[model samples]
Target: MTEPVRRRGRPPRAQQDAGPGMRERILDVAREEFAERGYDKASVRGIAKAAGVDPALVHHYFGTKEQVFAASIEMVLAPALEAPAALVDGPLDGAGERMTRFFFGVWDAPATRAPLLAIVRSALNNEVAAGVFRGLVASQLLARIAQRLDLPEGEAELRASLAAAQLVGTAMLRYVIKVEPLASADLEWVIARIAPVVQVHLTGP
Candidate 1:
């Protein structure tokens, strides 16, 4: 009998390890790789190696390095993205408090904090990562906030930038730097102090 013919292309490596959660696994690995190496250095091949899959598989799942990085950012920020919606239904006066609570709620959750922290830390030290982080935050988070508020294009971006600066600064102090009382303070206490500042940034003249 003639020997069975082998497949023309490389055998399916991802299928060998593939299962219900393979995509998620790849995303998780990609996030870590991007965080550790920054956007410029992180590669599909490396991510695939770390994820125990083939480079082609990474390409198959996520078109390019930029796409993978974008997916990773979305995954990390999914919970926090809900913050702007708090502005939609409530009185404008309480919008800041709602937004603040929503922002901290995600950070306080242990499940999401690790990847979020990784991105923040990496962004701080790596210019390439910082550019990616800034683009994602501006496009995804800040733009949503500006849209919800219905401000003029220029003013809306200004307001969004100010709000982001306030929250990001607070996060750096409370979570990253672990400043004296802010870090150790109750969440409500921190919220109380921060809400007004954010409120001013969002709504003040």
Candidate 2:
């Protein structure tokens, strides 16, 4: 009998270590792709190719664009995401100060800003990211804040949204877009000014 065709050579080295690393590779590629192209124009295939993995792997790690977007922003979201409900339930006095503290606390961290800056830039220019950003605020920040308070129907949604618009704008000018005085001013100065507005939205008329 004709010798059986020689079996294919050993799997490529890239494939050799691919099993557990696919998730990390996908994240690395997705972060770069999202930063460069933004969410609207980014393709799973392109990201997967850049990462040297299959497009299906991207889906396997992150089910949808929304999930990928959220995952990417995980660092930036932590402070607000964790603080909303807790602060709202915490001591009522000095709520504005507490809120301000939390905002600066997150932004002040060097580790948080890099990923945050990427997400901020993406959200501004990318349509998909804009929607995902809105969704994150709605579900994670706004919803949580609203649930803890005695706000009227739909007020939490509105209030949280309004708070987001303000915070996002401030972040853009101060950190991401890096506009004039806002960017240069001391952190405390900026937070002091914005926190009241946020406090009003979160706590009062």
Candidate 3:
């Protein structure tokens, strides 16, 4: 009998063994890769190699590098992203307070802070990562808030951008920089002081 021929193109054993959570595993590895390598340097092949799967599988799940970045952002910012739903039906006057509280709540939660901090740190130091992050915030977070505000196009964008500046600044000081007083202060106290600023930015003339 003739010897059997081996397959010409087969995945490595690692790829064949990926389990039900392969998508999540990809995201986890992608997060580290993006954090370490920034957006421009991180590659699908590298992420797949770290994730123990084929590059084809990464593409199969995420479609593109940008999509993978968006998914990683969504995973890190899920709480804040969902917080906007609370604004959908609430009084416009209180939107700022609600938004402020929601953000602080997410930041205050021990479970969510690590990934959030990692993203913020990476964005601060990496221009490519910063662009990806800034786009996500502008299109997803600020744009959503602007829509709910029902202001004119120009005014809404301005208001949302201002409010975002306040929140992002606060996060940078309190979490990333670990500034004195603000970093160690009580969560409710910080919310009280910052919410009004955010509220004015959102609704004040």
**lDDT by residue for model 2 over 1-205, one digit each (tens)?**
8955533433344455578866766777777787777777778778868987656566666877668777767635766688767776785445566766776667767877766777877887877787777777777876776676576768767876777677777877788868997878988888788888877876776
lDDT of each: 0.81, 0.72, 0.82
Decoy 3 TM-score against native: 0.82
Q: Is candidate 1 or candidate 3 better by lDDT?
A: 3
Per-residue alpha-carbon lDDT of model 1 for 1-205, expressed as tens digits? 9966635334275364577688899999999997678676889989999998877777777787877877798888876775576554677778788888888888888888778888888778767667778888887788877776767889978987898798889988988889988898999998998889988888888
* Model 2 residue pairs with clashes: none
Which sections of candidate 2 miss by over 4 Å?
A: 1-21, 63-67, 75-79
Runs in model 1 with CA error above 4 Å?
Answer: 1-20, 35-42
Better of 1 and 2 by TM-score: 1
> Against the true structure, what is every candidate's RMSD?
3.5, 4.9, 3.6
Candidate 1: 10-residue stretch with minimal lDDT: 5-14
Ranking by lDDT: 3, 1, 2
- TM-scores for candidates 1 onward, in order: 0.82, 0.77, 0.82
Q: In candidate 2, where is summed lDDT lowest over 10 consecutive residues?
A: 5-14
lDDT for each residue of candidate 3 in 1-205, tens digit (9 for 90 to 100): 9956535444445655677798899999998888778677889899999987788788777878878887898888876776686664589889888888888788878878877877887777767667878888787788888887668899988998999899889988998899998999998899899999998988897
